[model samples]
Target: MPAAMTIDLSAIPADQRDAVAAVLRERDALKEINRRLEHLVAELNHAVHGKRSEKLSEDERQLSFEDLETAIAEVEESQDTQLSSKGKTRRPVRRNRGNLPKDLPRIEHVIEPASLECPHCQKMGGCGVMHKIGEDRTERLDIVPAQLRVIVTVRPKYACRACTDGVTQMPAPAHLIEGGLPTEGAIAHVLVSKYADHLPLHRQSQILARSGIDIHRGTLADWVGTAAFHLGPVVDRLAEHLKVSTKLFMDETTAPVLDPGRGKTKTGYLWALARDDRAWGGDDPPGVVFFYAPDRRGENAEKFLRGFDGVLQLDGYQGYNCLTRPSRKGGDPIRVAHCWAHARRKLKEVFDRDGSEIAAEGLRRIAEFYRVEANIRGTAPGQRLSARQARTVPLVAAFGEWLQEQRLRVSAKSRLGEKLAYIHRHWDGLQTFLHDGRVEIDSNSVENLIRPIALNRKNALFAGHDEGGRTWGRIASLIETAKTNVVEPFAYLKATLEAIAAGHPKSRIDELLPWNFTPSS
Candidate 1:
């Protein structure tokens, strides 16, 4: 539908002018509806086969398009139903929903007819035999409400017949929550539900209430605090483990914390440090450790990265300018490698605001870098270095020359000029990947890991206190790191809690980590 056109309603009769205004309003609504539909259609086409600076993963694309199309359908209004034109009654396509897993326990319901014998056979004095030759089977999914069950521990008393011996029984087994109602498995479920599932304590309490269990959200917080206390050492170990790597990705997000002194919420931070060696096929396993700090001061980052001495790939945050210093107290100066995604995004913003050919060309050049990265992604670091040097070196040189030429022609005050300036200012860090194969082109590794924290933050709104923020970081760190290792969080956490309660030695603490996860462990 076209936009509503302006008309000389004042020249017409007043009575008809009112009707004309109403029609104009309706036309505007239609125009808006059409616009919404067109936008969704464009995104759908893009997901299907679109021009992009980077490609979304296959699973990501599939899930995205499916949801996008469903939303498109749900946006239809009553007038849209009437606009079907031909309204041809086409058969609804039967999509193939894959078969249910064989491992899933199924309950059988044998539906039988009142009479097995055919009516014709009975009428003909049973001349034809109605015997079973085969059985038809159909499977549909069903669900049972989750039920809470109690585990009873029996410690029978034993007595000696002579000498008035005291009654004796084996000592009760230790639990993660000492003498509390929840078992290790139950605590693990609660932790996973809150952190990974992003269900706040109040919501979880409500969920537990549905199962006839009365648990206060404050008690849930206590449980989480206890879990945090025991998990602190583990998180410390994990952070130290991450620091061992020569190169790592880093980023931070705001964590709103309640300030009891002022009786209101204050901004905090959860910094993510990540390592993904599979990109260059290195030996170190992937992991992420989140640190919660009261503020995003330079010292906070500096403290968190004390032992980490090598390249840190991150965004254009000036707080990390301290790392650029030639001389720092503790160890060798931490080298900073800035993100190309950040640089590209600067120009992409310009392109979005106004269709600038310069911005488009800049994005095109960045896209070429990603294209090369896609091919040699899983190769070894030395091999990646060889590929980048041979292929990306000349491209980078050409891009730099082109950037300088454009910058000279445009004013520094312009949007395109400002973005080009950013690239030029961070020219050394932007080319860091070309020099060191171990470092990634961007800090996306850590950014991807931090997304759940954002989701959790949104749901919970804010942490109750400074300690609450720290507790959030500790539990989330282990859960998300488990995911990076392809380990199921519930299982890993359950086993770890059990192991801790059973007095697993600190000397072998690494045994309880996610990578060592096994079903029977």
Candidate 2:
């Protein structure tokens, strides 16, 4: 072991103390640089050989700086407590494995012994009988392949016995498509398969073919178009419902559509608006609506959100910035709440690349705000507002000051500098959560709602045309919203189509929404 070196300030001359302090600062800087270099090498190695997403794995947590801070806090608290504590330490307990859902019907198969006679007295055939005993049981999951069946409707003709009366027959039931081969259930199945399961119509056509049913892909497409036409009223109502919410989360994702003459796909945008007040314990049910636009211009957002006048939570996209700007017509501008996750993501990238202390500190400060949010997560809006005012407000103020100080220290052109500038620019929007507890700190809810569209895009590659894209959005909106409401998409869509076929009134369309829908047996 090396001997410890100690410096006594009193022994040193006052003039030389300044030089000593300068040397100590240089040593600390060198140590920090070395630490960063080591971290960078490790990160590079992981990037080359490990999983793509930057999310920490179980093993990676051991080296995580955030985990380090948590461990230190735990150690400090443990040191403050007595060794023989009265309270028990909460060791993590393993939970019992859950059985299969009781809702699923079970079929049993029993295996019997080949010989009923006892082995001890087989020659004598003891007792000439076998007594009852307990039996062992096990379960195995099974699936039934898709089967196609035809429904034959026969209408009996009736004629009056009196002379020259016109023949009368029972009117046929209302079908989604008059005289069409597919039933309402079949059409609902295709829609749910394409939109919810991300299966393209072409693949569905092939699957149907395997089941000995040959329906052309073009015909399937027509069926989808018809479904969209009939579901249009429901989509309109859903959009209106989403807009009426006081707080809404908005996001957009790229959707490619085929260009007829160009022989290639043109980029389109799917704008998603979602309302989820469950986090703040509000009574409103969660729902999402999607709109497809040919372009991602500011005018499109303006047009789509024309009637919406409330807090709009979104990311750092500049197109949405126009919504908050003073319009030439002069009206109440939509209040924008910037996503803290986006801001934190920028700094996280910096940390991942260079492991800079500045980025880490920024994340640490932002994490403090989220910590406050976690404490008030499921509380009522009033309680959440009170908690935010008591805890988050002061922390945000201090973080803002620290950010300003950081901006002054870093080079303006550097990556970290650019990120700090973004934070400073959106400071007011980021602080919106401090004023209104109903607004989320990030627009992750909307982003999550857009992920299904991204998956569908990956599978279908591109929509056939702009109209097809619009149809895709309308159907996906209902399916996803049903999923959000915990309603089975197929059951909801089937019931909805049947109701529409039965001439359900447009004036009472609210009952057809996913939240209010009741599945038919």
Candidate 3:
């Protein structure tokens, strides 16, 4: 159906024919090379100007330790079992139909036919009798808009008739905001909506107006500040708990605060420290606390982490080097555990930009380390240490040797060379997991914890002031910690606010922590 090309050697000179063929081959090769070059340029542009989440997709390959452990066990069990000689059969994958909460109330509606007479009988009411056969049922979710109402407290006064020495009246119930318009539940709702759901105060006020509640945004801010003031003690306890941990995953993100005098927003840092031992099967409950600093200087990190001596997991930021220095005061030097994900990110950028084989090999080598980690994850600390020594130690040594060899071969100023140098400089820290089983390969857990703050930042744009940023940090700490512990944040906040209003003792404040919290309590 198609025409075919035919070439005749006799029609053309021999020397010219060879030259023509060479030119055609060269053109084809140039076209392919130009295509690749264009692709590389596009990838570089996307990396430099596109969204930051492109890197997150690459990092997601490093699964959580618990999940990796389960996968490893399943693979091992399958390998140990006998296989059938018959060809393998594949089963269909079932799609998930999400379930509604069991606690949610359900409303039922029943429908019956207009006439109960059977069509076959053709008699009125089917011989004057009808029986039910079956019913088809369907369910749909519904919601009730938030309702606003007043809670009137009546404290009737009584006087003694015989002796009017003194008049006594029943005491009024305690409220989070004394004589304030909103109730404890209302304040809790606002806090959860603002911080957890990232709804700004003005937007919440607008929503409330639709319900016929004429509350000002300023009043909502006052309620938030009041709630933060009462929750201060609990946040303090959370900070203390986080500081005492032998290991912590730390990261920081920028938070802009409004400057009244300058009429512009100033940069601030929201420092996040998280502890999650469940990945290693430890008994300690997972929690995270945040601190807001005016800047991202090393001193802020030093001040925040003062009186703490243990492994501090983070990315390669020079600010943290002070904590790891021997001359640091108040405690032993904090061991720095650098994130391999960061190094992999550097290599990933290089690979995306130029498609270098060295960068690809570096990623492959790092992936191997993660593969060994997957096999040993969630085991006892001692067992994990032994497995790393036997399995991971050699791979690290070989990888280090390969890195050194590549460093000597490549130019120091090249991008791939720079990434290799970074790995060499942080080699000890990157291999910290080989020394201790408790340390993770990266600080992604804390990074994941900080994602909500990033979301809030995108919504709110900036904080009102330095104090407002601090309040954001404090409130986010409690809400995020509650989420980490699987506690319903709204229920926890409502109960905690009520307890504080009712004069709950600060000495027993730990009882109100997300881990120890119960709705009834």
Give one digit per residue, the lDDT tens place, for model 1 in 1-521: 44556898898898899888876766666666678788889889888876451356444676788898887775554336434433634335345566787778989998776877788988978856467778897777888765689999999989999868698899999998888988888888889999999999999899889888999999988888888898888888888888989998989999999988998999999998888887888888888888999999877888889888989999988888887776654567888899989999898788877879999999999899998898889888888899999999888899999999999998999988899998998898889999888878888888889988988887899999888899899999899999999998999999899889888899998887777778772
Task: Give the number of the best model, judged by TM-score.
Answer: 1
Candidate 1 overall lDDT versus native: 0.85
Cα lDDT tens digits, model 2, 173-243, are 99999999988989999999999899999999999998888999999998999999999999999999888
Q: Is candidate 2 or candidate 3 better by lDDT?
A: 2
- The alpha-carbon deviation from the true structure for residue 120 of candidate 1, after best TM-score superposition, in angstroms, is 4.5
What TM-score against the true fold does each predicted structure earn?
0.84, 0.80, 0.80
Model 3, clash count?
0
Off by over 4 Å in 1: 1-96, 118-120, 127-131
How many clashing pairs per prediction, in order? Answer: 0, 0, 0
What overall lDDT, based on C-alpha atoms, would model 3 receive against the true structure?
0.84
lDDT of 3 by residue, 1-521 (tens): 23434556567898799877765565555455455556555654554466443554332323333344455445434423312112333234334445677677888777877877666677444454468978786666677887678888888888899997987998888999998888899999999999999999999999999988889999999999999999999998988888888899999999999999999999999999899887688888899889999899987888888778889999998888888888876678898899999999999899888889999998999998889878977888888889889988998899999999999999999888889998888988998988888888888899989988988997999999999999999999999999999999999999999999999997899988888888763
Candidate 1 has what TM-score?
0.84
Question: In terms of TM-score, which candidate is stronger, 1 or 3?
Answer: 1
**Candidate 3 has what TM-score?**
0.80
